[model samples]
Target: MTAVALLLTALFLAPTGALAADKIVIGVPTSLNFLEGKEANNSVKLAVDEINKAGGVKVGGKMLPFVVESIDIRDAAPGVPVPEALLGIEKLILEKKPNALVVGPFRSEALLAGMDMLAKHKVPLLGTIAMSPKTEAKVASDPKYKYVFRVSLDAKYFVGYIAGVMGFLGKEFGFNKVFIMNQDVAWARATAGIMTKIFEGKLKWKVVGHETFPTGASDFAPALMKAKMAGAQVIMPVFDMPQSGILVKQWKAMKVPALMAGFISPLTGPGAWKTFDGKIGGALNAIFELGNIPSAKYPPSKKYYDAYQAKYGVPLEAGHGPAPSYASVYLLKAAIEKAGSLDPDAIVAALKATDAQGVMGHIKFSKGNQLIYGNDPQKEALGCFFQWTDDGKRLIVYPPAIAEGTIKLPAGMKAAK
Candidate 1:
């Protein structure tokens, strides 16, 4: 053969498509019995499975299937040390060597600790459920944090809705006094702080009582009695802990008259009524998403909800956790396709320019590399305050445009005339 023919052959074979397909691995280090983690795991699996079924994703002229690797970061909350979470992530990295992680540790404590390892290994992650402002603040200002991206609502994004709901309840019910029950964590504290400011300074409501409890406390009777005696019209508990289940159950059993709202994770799921054995009647919760309600302005939102129900035979537990987890996988794919390579730096750059629409809406990252929401009512995310009906359905009562029903007071309580 001629020398020129041999050179041409070499050039044709040089395309990356001729090489082995790239494997995109997802690592989820969630705690045991935490429904949010399981929801995220299943949601991610659904997205990955769908992509694989459709001939996988094409990158650099080659189709590559996604690979998922999950681990249990036991006791993964603020009470646990940061090093323990770091160890769990390190294990996943050593075992899987993931190209990218769509979901990571569930809370800010673990996320903050796991960032350094992710950066060192050059693994790009799109976090789904960690809601601390520090996660974005650090990534935005520090070059060391370039690899970490948050696709879910953070502290600032969620606080706006919570405060808005508090203001609405005040005006709607003529409730003039409020009490705050906050768990001692960064996300809860930040939410409580903003709510206090909005309820006191802007809404002109009296601050009746402020209570702080450690996570995992089963008894809320003392705090409940204190708020009731202080004449608080609203009781805002700002925490995502499982013990929050105890607070809601106790409130009903003890017959606390004040309205319970804000950061109510335990009450967000469909089975919550049965969990407490019908003890959570008339309880208000700030739910970021719901399948039945027109919570998401985006049309694809309903499609996601239907798919999830068909696959799992149950409603999504916490919409923020699973919805964002499923969306993050697609977002990562979009970024990789735009970049045309699996290189982390290129993917990060493409993510910065992301404006793709997902189940949540048209998702775009802010300067801090955090997903932005709630700025536009017609287009972006809008959280609802839902109260449980007597028949066990969550009825949206805030932001009248999409509300399923009006807010009804608990059987014994009356709104001011």
Candidate 2:
């Protein structure tokens, strides 16, 4: 192994039990059982190492390096209660007293409840997951919640992007009828609802059926059958859990004719086709970071894509975990430097004024303490809608300016008549 690789491996694998002097502890309180959790931790560690090597953030006349301290909130998988996640974050904060946080609770319920603790403790956090619109409301309504920021796109923004793609499909294949399937969770349901309103109101598409499935529920046949029976042309599924694997496998096996699109965390990466045993073909996934499905229209995506592969020895996966969490770290660093101290409120102010290029593209915080997104890769942090081919290839087919190919249906499936 090269010297750089050895050094990175040491830092990544290093124990967080002890803290060195003049180091800023970046706490990661997320569910370790999920892919997003693991990737979030990995990406945060990678970014901290990169920043430390480059003469760490200067604050209060001292160079403060970054160290990662994480706790397993265990909410991404089923069975963990929201209260338990609340306690986990509380413990991570009281014990570690990290200068800042990243990749917080994986579920919206925990995030809503955890927001109180974060505000009470006055620890600034940059969350990459848990996209509930309520999060924005909380930040907007209360000044105490100003310490919290979502680096990843929220559900509303996600729905906006998906709605446009669905509209394009309506024009492309004459699709009209739609089916909405979402995990019984706040984030998924919100995304599904927002898309439904847009489809029915602005897009003039017919809504065939809308169903909510329990989290961790593996049987998707019932919904697929209903969608087919309703003569739906598009299947919009919002799932953040790993059950997406089951959903796609069932979709392919059952030969569902509708175009599957929306947010499926499991199918967000370049390796998704292989991950689901090549069953995800023809499914269009809405990614949180453009890098999740890497496009040539953006150079930063390529840089982050290659660096992740080199550091982790695998393609980046686990929803929008890696890239967003990686970017969040640099954001926190920049905020700290801009504030020139470890004061939480000052960091929050710096973050609000942030306008830096991330792993995807340009990033700036608009209203609601969320990153702004636009169609132009050169302008804002942009994401795309991509479809998978049968032989495991990802095609960037949306936002015409950055599109590499047109959306295609799975072989043997015909477009809506």
Against the correct fold, how does model 2 do in TM-score?
Answer: 0.87
lDDT of residue 29 for candidate 2: 94
Q: 21-76 in candidate 2: lDDT tens per residue?
A: 47788999998767878887888888898899998988877897898999998987
lDDT for predicted candidate 1 compared with the true structure: 0.77
Residue 6 Cα positional deviation in candidate 1, in Å, after optimal superposition: 14
Per-residue lDDT for 23 in model 2?
76
* Candidate topping lDDT: 2
* Poorest lDDT segment (10 consecutive residues) of candidate 2: 14-23
Error of 2 at 216 (Å): 4.4
Top model number, TM-score: 2
Over 4 Å off, model 2: 1-21, 216-226, 241-243, 253-255, 412-417
The residue ranges of model 1 lying beyond 4 angstroms of the native Cα positions read 1-19, 75-80, 184-186, 253-255, 288-298, 375-378
